[model samples]
Target: MRSLFTIGLIASWYASNIGVLLLNKFLLSNYGFKYPIFLTLCHMMACSLLSYIAIEWLKIAPMQRVKSRLQMMKISALGFIFCLSVVGGNISLRYLPVSFNQAVGATTPFFTAVFAVVMTSKREGWITYVTLVPVVAGVIIASGGEPLFHLFGFMMCIGATAARALKSVLQGLLLSSEGEKLNSMNLLMYMAPVAVMALFPAALYMERGVVGITIALARDDWKFLIYLLFNSALAYFVNLANFLVTKHTSPLTLQVLGNAKGAVAVVISILIFKNPVSITGMLGYSLTVAGVILYTEAKKRSM
Candidate 1:
């Protein structure tokens, strides 16, 4: 029963992630939503509002109050990083195919390992470190052959991936030692609002005139509004599902699920977008994914 529950969580995470990514791509790439930052702000807003209702009204989890100035600062810092990571990801989608983006994102485990070692002085065996080689090499190979590679988009994707990895490492380090370490749902409740605050000015400045355009577009097509709402709604589910998955299973299982998710997302994007991928790109992504699986297995064995 526990295994079945874990499988369900994994399936939910996969479905939510894939659905959200495809929707965002369709909105940004096909539907001509040019302001990725603004779109990201919308996502954050939805997350914040839902998180508040979930914690405060629905009582899904006890509301965790901000206990200390220091803790607030810490979470705020995390929120800022989260904004960068998510905004960067959305921006990348504007210039890159979803397939290539997911391919590049496959390198996140490498960044996670590096940050874990640097942040916590944790040591991994040489075999563990060596596994990262193929993960990185595969991405580079795929990048070189990416049919629609944009330099700016590639850089943003890499930055987003690294920031994501750093968030995981820092959250573990900082939150573990806190007197009151909030669970994932409460953590999202606090982080989502701060992330919105961090993103607002940037969205306002960078997306000047975009608001009116989007509003006009939405007015013409009510479906645009629906897509935006659905996109943001899925974002919330992604966070909720991730938290539930972690609660039900070990982090190792989540990591392994992530490896599969990346590959599946890439394939789905290729099919949906009809993006042309080179043979070299396919081989490269395969190596990266295989490396990620090896890394996960190695870590699990070590544990």
Candidate 2:
């Protein structure tokens, strides 16, 4: 029964994660909603509201309070990084096929390892370091063979991936102390509103007239509102499911699941979007995923 529950949580995480990606791609790429910043803002807003309800009112997770001004500053910094990652991801989806985007995103472990070394001066074993070679090489191969490749989209996706890894490193650095540590749910509870605040001015500056455009679009199609709402809700669920999965299982299991999730997402995306994938592209993606799995195993053994 416990194993069944874990399976359900994993399934939910996959669904929420992939669902949000597809919905974001559809809204930005096909549905004519081109404002990635605004879309990300809506997601943060939903996360902020839902996290509060889940932690405070519903008692789904214990409430955690920001203990100090310095802690608040750290969380704000994380929120800024989170905004960059999410908005960049959404923008990329407009220009890149979902499969290609996921392909680029699969290099995140490589970035994370690099950041850990550069930022913290932590060194991994030679075997672990060597594993990253194929991770980088595979992306290079995929880029050359991607039929729908957009240079701008590739850059944005890479930037988002690096920012994501940086966030993980920074979180460990900034919140490693027992007093400062907050579980994922509580962290989201605080971080989401900060992200919304950080995103608002940028959205206004970068996506001028988006508000009016979204409103007009919604007026023409009431279902647009539904799409936004559902997408935003899934955004929150993605984080929730991730935290739950990690809590119920081990972090190693989560890492393994995440690697598989990227592959599954790529296949589902290709099927749904009807994106053309060259044989080289698929081989490159396979190599990258294989490298990630090897990296995970190497890290596990080192630990």
Alpha carbon lDDT of each predicted model: 0.88, 0.93
**Residue 42 of model 1: what lDDT?**
87
TM-score of every prediction relative to native: 0.95, 0.98
Residue 74, model 2: lDDT of 99
Per-residue CA lDDT of candidate 2, range 1-303, in tens? Answer: 999999999999999999999999999998978899999999999999999998889887888789999999999999889889998899999999999999899999999999999999999999999999999999999999999999999999999999999999999999999999999999988889999998899888999988888888889999999999999999999999999999899999999999999999999999998999999999898889989999999999999
Best by lDDT: 2
Q: Where in model 2 is the C-alpha error above 4 Å?
A: none
Q: What's the CA RMSD of model 1 in angstroms?
A: 1.6
